[model samples]
Target chain A: MSENSTYAEITEAIRAHDSFILLSHIRPDGDAIGSQLALGHALEAMGKTVHYINEDGLPDNLSFMAESQRIQTPPAEPLDVQVCIALDCATKPRLGENALHAASKAKLWINIDHHISNPAYGDLNHIDSTSPATGQILYQLIKSADMPLPDATRDAIYVAVSTDTGSFQYSNTTAATYEMAADLVRRGLDVGTINAQIYDSNPYRKIELLRSLLNTLQLENDGKVAHWELPYSVKEEYNLKPEDSEDQIDLIRGIDGVVAAAFFEELEDGKIRVSLRAKDDTFNACETAQLFGGGGHARAAGIRMAGPISDAREKVLAAISNAIS
Target chain B: MSENSTYAEITEAIRAHDSFILLSHIRPDGDAIGSQLALGHALEAMGKTVHYINEDGLPDNLSFMAESQRIQTPPAEPLDVQVCIALDCATKPRLGENALHAASKAKLWINIDHHISNPAYGDLNHIDSTSPATGQILYQLIKSADMPLPDATRDAIYVAVSTDTGSFQYSNTTAATYEMAADLVRRGLDVGTINAQIYDSNPYRKIELLRSLLNTLQLENDGKVAHWELPYSVKEEYNLKPEDSEDQIDLIRGIDGVVAAAFFEELEDGKIRVSLRAKDDTFNACETAQLFGGGGHARAAGIRMAGPISDAREKVLAAISNAIS
Candidate 1:
């Protein structure tokens, strides 16, 4: 009836719901986990039976999310959730294997997201693309419910908003994001400690993996494209995991001459998982990724190609070259 | 003489000295300028006549040093100073032209530095290699003298100490560094503001220059060595000074496989100045710099080679290869 449902209607639905389940997208990013956990904690504070579940395993870095240890694989039994809430997922399919099926059976599906491409899949969708993250929407929801957020919930929300905005540095950051950050800071959140834990803590093995990757770097297209490949043997030799190599592509992209940087990791299936980063606005790594059936943002993106690392690298470079020209 | 002079003796000498001059090393770094200004402020507090001078012009990034505008070039007039304080010079020659003659003419020469190679060329040398920066030594000197350090002085000292220790991440940092940092933090030094100003703030032109540099990146030796060259025309095109390009070499060195990274800037003097950075403990960039009669720390170093850019690049790569081998 309303252009956008009133806060009162949303509150009424939340109160009427008996059982709530919160879900995030596959390969959950910080915003995904942060929003899921924060909203779940807020609901639990209201004496609601809240279950925070994810189909994909939690990223090791975002393991500090609230009730993170309690997040089990999707229950085998059919869920009877009165309300299903999805955080940070643009499409229903992005809820991955478990939550997608559960959402279909729920009495009412509520989608909370900040993605511009959100499909409004839920019966009650609160999609504010201007918000830095879905966690920002959850903050307002908690306030509307008149529930006091605990420090843990606040920390979860902080991580969600902070990381989504690149610690309040990326182009996505808005004045409202700073207002939210200032409010979070006033609530005695240790921003420095949180930043150090999230962004600065690098293990020795990860540094070694970086060293190994730097050893195989190549420049193409007159040094505009920087590419590197890390073999499975090197990862095994260094005792490094796939997650440990995260952000290595961004580091390469940070080089002064690099407009685009690609890092290829040979998967066990003989496929190569490629990560791409664009340092300039003139190029969009995401568009290149989309060409390979992958999608992401303009500056950062990735795709997986089933082939040898060399073949994958060549294909990605050709795409980038064509795009740039 | 006492095993260690008491606070009273130091205070008496500072109070008694009328004409005080401060000198830092040639190719002065942040620590050198910071130490000189912090000590100058403390000396001025004691009603001493002070003049801060450097031979080479201040690097633009470090132009925020206290009273930096008041710094004078080497004077042709003879100096008859009662007290001459050399802040961060490792050797007398390192003081450059400003204090070359005055250092000999001064009635009392006091050396305050943190360089391990300090020659102790002063009548009273307070060289503590264990300290993080010369500013740390200056902090101790002021505290030992029982002098009240102003907020500005405290801020400058914090900058010096922090920058020299790579924001407390470098190997040179010690337990005392944290203790000093804590003391400064307690004095209401806004670290976030300082860090944002020093590390985060980059001019638009500098960004453009960085973009240009990234366009010329070259990787070799299995990507263990990364190199980029910026001609004088490019710098002029971007309206960038040499100081604006200070961090370019380190950015290249941070590439995944790059054990060594170099940036060759063609100077107006028909010579190419090479800035080098080495990551692993096994490779020392300073050793490579020494091949061209230049010197620096293990991780970062520089050299000036007179030749065409291509020839100089080849020579530098050959020398670095030799050093690593």
Candidate 2:
């Protein structure tokens, strides 16, 4: 009924339908989990049945969310949801294998995200790149639904926004971000404790992995570009999962004189996952990821290549060098 | 005179003295700068002429302190100071070359610090190991002096206390620490802006270096220890100075299972400066640093070894292996 039929319209679609399913991107980050869980909480608060699914397991760091365990891989039963909402995912294919199928099967599909690269695959798309995180858009949608947010919902939304914006330190943080944070804070969310748990609470093994990474640092092109790689053996020795190395790339990128930093993790499948961070305006890692059929923000980005480690390294270096030159 | 003679006695010594100088230990951290500057500010407020000397140059990151520019290296000026007060230094030898000379020349010598290992080298030593940082002691001393604290003095004191206790997240943070911080906040110090400036303002070059470090990560000793090194050539190419790598050791120490993280930086002199951080209760990097005649706290420590890279690596690894085994 509303003239502005994007987010509000999507909310109505979700309410009008009974059972709902939520999905996010492959190798999901905070925004994906945040948008998924926040919407799920909102739907459940409204007395609607909702199921959240992600093919990849929840990242260890984000496992603290209340409904994290409820997020399943996929339902064995055929997609029975009247409506399905894909949150914080760009392309439909990014939903991995299971959720992608569910998205196709649902009678009404709604897409909600903040990614500029969103493919708009759903029957209804409500994407606002201006929002700092998908959680912000979901907050607006929840408000429009005339439902009061509970404490659990507030916690999830706060984390969703906080993690995506790098704890309000990144450039993406805007006035809206602060307003949303203040709102969440007012809802009995302890920002300081949450920040400590998210950023400060680190297990010992992750520290070891970081030390190993720093040991092999290399710089090129007059220190304008920095690169490092972790072989598969190192992961096995350290008993380190991919998630354990999540924040390592940022450490190297913080060195003085480094314009860009690239980290290579040799996967068991003979593929290399490259995490890139750009420190200066002269380099854009997202564009670099795009060249390899991947994309992310300018400051942080990644690409996955299935090939020999050396070959993938050479290719990535060539692409980055060419871009800088 | 107050019954607590230690603080009053120290304040009077500083006030009565003409041509006074202050010094801190080598590789001074926030506590060192904070204590030095707070004392300097207090002395200036009380109409006493004061000179501060740090033989080593000021760290680039802490240049925001008001007295950072006033910090002087000892020159050929005759040693006319009636007294020298060493703040936050464990031992007289820890004072760098020039400050050491100044300390020896003063008519009266005093040592004020919070290190448990302090040698009590000064003629008048006020060492309180229970105190979180020397800034706390200086706060008491300033209060006892009944000198009005200016905004700059409050800022310097706050920086010292904040950084030393890891922004109130570390184990060293206590009720006393909070009380001091609360008082500083009451004096109109913007805690958020200070924290943002100290922790959030990352240089582009630093991010690039972080990326490089992350790329080369390795996990050793069954994930208990993570080791990484940055060679001088790489640092030179990246235009990164030694100070830029300050937090690399801490980043590695944050891994999920890692107990210890060691970052080895190859100095221009071909010496490797190993910075260590411990995440677990079992491992102590400071003890490891002590094996090489360096010292620090249990969680964080450092050592400088002069040798061929391979030899130094082997020695350091052997020491670490011994510690864990």
Candidate 3:
């Protein structure tokens, strides 16, 4: 086992177990999928039976990862592996029910993540809040373990780090992020190709949906907050899939003088899905999301509520107003 | 002098001079401003009197750089400097007449740039086409001279590198780009704050103009081309200055299924300003811009036209159709 790994115990467990299963959060993002696939490839190289599983499956945007096909959406049969490792999920609930049950069959549960708010819920937890992405932490572990960082591992980690750090544009990016990115490029990651596919390859339908959403843009509290509502009907009208609305909140947040931005999606079951993005803790997205039984980082957070979008809009705006005022 | 610098003679000239004038291209961008300011400060540290000159002066957004106050817009006095350096301007015409006459008055004329198309219209030229931004090359020069790089220099270089590289998201970004950015961040550049002000601080008027522009979006040749025409009237109608329409073309270029995008703006003189953006040289933006006597990089390019908005739009679309066909 590598000495640099804070979780040498986790590596020892991996060595002891001949088989393993990897799981990530529901509605898997780049960090979740990248970490899962990177770790899975490393373990598989050791002749271990590695199953990379996600409950909600891969999002449409991250389809470019080299090992994307390896990500399974919870196979029909129950898992029976010796060791289970959860990557990027902050809590058991984040894994959703079925993936949790499948992973529970394993004797050892290892959790690895980089979220500041992680609860460290696993038989062995190695959470480095300082890391901008879980794949970053995994990179160090792979380097320390003397594991071969084949192109697949490097590509997956590149996706994880770039998306998590907004292509190294976010505040979380450090000297280490750039330092690591340089190493990944040397290890056969085509930075340009990966960036183009992950970011620039938007389907036309998404822009069509965006056209209508931008029309719905409204400002509140003296333009300190910007938001738009997307009813379930808009999705049906535009033939939009779930991922079509991804990052639409940025359009609102990118507007000048907007301290906070929110995206409201009306679910079919008379429920509303709200994602909040704030410039900083002054707006407190996490606290606002917590009021609705959802949570996330201070800059970005979300919640689900049983109400009409109009009602949710009224409520969330009030919360944001209170947070900032 | 740094062994890495090809223009050691340029540095020698700098060390030999007591008074200098630095000129950048018209409608100066962050690179023009940043390189000029960084080098100007370095020259001033050597107790040289330096005048940073630009025809149109600094963009409103980069007011954060410490030396912005020193940027002069076509100062009344003629140049009396011992040495003159052109920063980031590719050709004499790029200096827009006034600065060229000013720069020509110096005893020695030097050109420092990263453009491949530079004509080397100076007594000494230092052109590194492989370097993504002129600032990247200048950093080595500053380091070689053993000049003190204060926060101002670091921030200015960051602006130059980041804006030219599209915040390090462009294809030109390499291991060295990140390496240099890391060094800058360590040298007191607040990457997050600087990035937010330079990028995230768009005035609401721009989005207002974008709203109307998106409404005008139309697809041609099976959506291979996406375009919108902004009759210069919109600027006056929206109470917008010229710079407000900057980066507006990206909104059209960012749309999916568009191989090439164009923004047709009617100039005050009835001629149109045509800017073309394409994914690759196969759609050749420079070639398209050149069709109307405009020139720029392969990916992004611009030109001014002598025709009605409708005629230029039709002609450009036909040319784009021909180029891709």
Candidate 4:
């Protein structure tokens, strides 16, 4: 159990270890699952035994990736692995109980993540907050260490970075991101096919949710703040999953002359889920979220509060108006 | 007019010319205006007098670029210049009559574009249809010729290619497109700021249009073909301009099970403007468009046919269902 590990140290550990298990955050995203597969595939290419496990297994949307089936639920018993690697997880507990129990047998622990909030709980940590996605960090690590990059690793890396960066639309995207994508394309990654799968494939429920949300959309504070609400009834009517409404707030946030956008949704548990997005640094979404004991980044943040959707919307809109003013 | 010209030949023309006028097609988009600005700024940096003129002028969305102010409407009198370079236009007349008149005084005509249908209607033509955008072509020509890349040219090139490639998500996006973007970022492009301006800024009217379109959305052929109609009445009610409804068809096109999507808009002159987008090569949008005497590429095409909107939708949807089947 040492301190922070360099790319060389990480690579050396990979070379030295015989068996490994990889885990990412629960309710896995492209970065979470993609990071594990990318580094896992690279290790497998080097003739190392690697197991990929996630608390929630893989989401239905990510089933398009041919090798995503490698990510499975943790077995009933802990596996006989010498080293355990945690990727794209901000904290140890976020990996879920079953995943941790499955990795308990590993003698050594390695943590690789890009979240600034990560506590470096692993025995050996490689935390790079400046990197937009853990996938980007793995790409740098693999390239720096000259790891064997299989086609699985190549496409996985692109999806991981591309999704985390909002298909390279987010402000966090860097020159290295584009450079990495360019290299991946040169390595035979089909940008069109992958991008279509990632962006164009939307469930019909999502559109129904969008139509419902738009019906509830409103402008306030002289059109500088735009907000919308979704009652639990609409969710029931559409039989919508939580992921169905993901990023739907962008519809209002994208409106010109609006500096801030807010989405208020009523949860079945009698709580309101609030998502806030700011267009610029002038208004801090995290700060506004913090006012309600929630947290996130400058431009995007989330909150959960007691609701009757109307009351929740009023309180949040007031805070947003105050912040932007 | 001479036949096809090489990169070297186009460079030689630029070097030889003292005064130049740049023009693109009417209803200029980011690629059209961006290509003009990118090459115009480069030539201006090389001590050449450059006049930036377009028939329809810059769209409001693209005005965020600082150098975009240079893209002006064609003046009544023809410009006195040694050369006129038409960028991103497929046909000569697409540049509009006013733009052609403005360029009438130029002795040499140089056409640089990425559209495959472009006729070689210039004294020198550099048409690389394989390139995704005219901006990518300009970036390559500038870098290959070792021309000075001013900040304006660098930013302009990024926007040109980004918008044309749907932020590099389209099938036409190439490895070189990503490479060019990487180069622009390295040369001090603030990708976050520019991208926000390009993507996040949408007028409220656009959202209104989306709401109206969504209400009319329908899925036919067992959800394989999705179609939506926009009646002329809704346009009048929303006080909408044509640009407000641009790309709205993508909402339906992106549905998970949809193989092809169509948008039927009732125009003021008893015409229905139909835009068809296919998800894969199996559904040839151009072929279907040609059935109604319209044409475009394999994946995306358009047709303007006589309509009551119902008849147009029925005809187009059937064609799409047949194509997909």
Best by TM-score: 4
Error of 3 at A45 (Å): 2.7
Q: Put down candidate 4 lDDT per residue, A188-271, tens digits, no spaces.
A: 999889989988998999999998898888999999999998999899999999888887887788787888989998999989
lDDT of 3 by residue, B3-38 (tens): 223556777878887999999889888899999988
lDDT of 3 at A211: 73
Regions more than 4 Å wrong, model 3: A1-5, B1-8, B231-233, B260-325
lDDT of 3 by residue, A1-325 (tens): 1112355666777888887889998888888999998888888888889988889888877877887888878866678788888899888789978787777679887888887677877778888878889999999888877776777888899888888877677777888888888888777677678887888776767767777787888999899999988988888888887777877787678677899999999988979999999865468898999998999887788899978888899988999899899
Q: Put down candidate 1 lDDT per residue, A1-325, tens digits, no spaces.
A: 1134555667788888878988998878788888878878777877888877888767777765556775655776657778898889977877887766755567887878877667788778787877778888888777777776987788889888877765544555554555555566567776556665666555546656665676677778776787888887787788776578876665556555567888899877788888888766768988899899876677677788887888887788899999887
Model 3 lDDT at residue A85: 89
Count clashing pairs, candidate 2: 47
Pick by DockQ: which candidate is best?
4
lDDT minimum window of 10 residues, candidate 1 chain A: A1-10
lDDT score, residue A308, model 1?
87
Report how far off residue A146 is in candidate 4 (Å): 2.6
DockQ of each: 0.05, 0.12, 0.59, 0.78
Predicted candidate 2 versus true structure: per-residue lDDT over A100-162, tens digit per residue? 675556788788888877767778888787887898888888777776587767878878887
Local accuracy of candidate 1 as per-residue lDDT tens digits, B232-269:
88877888876788776766676566788899899987
* Whole-model lDDT values for every prediction: 0.75, 0.76, 0.82, 0.90
lDDT of 4 at B236: 94
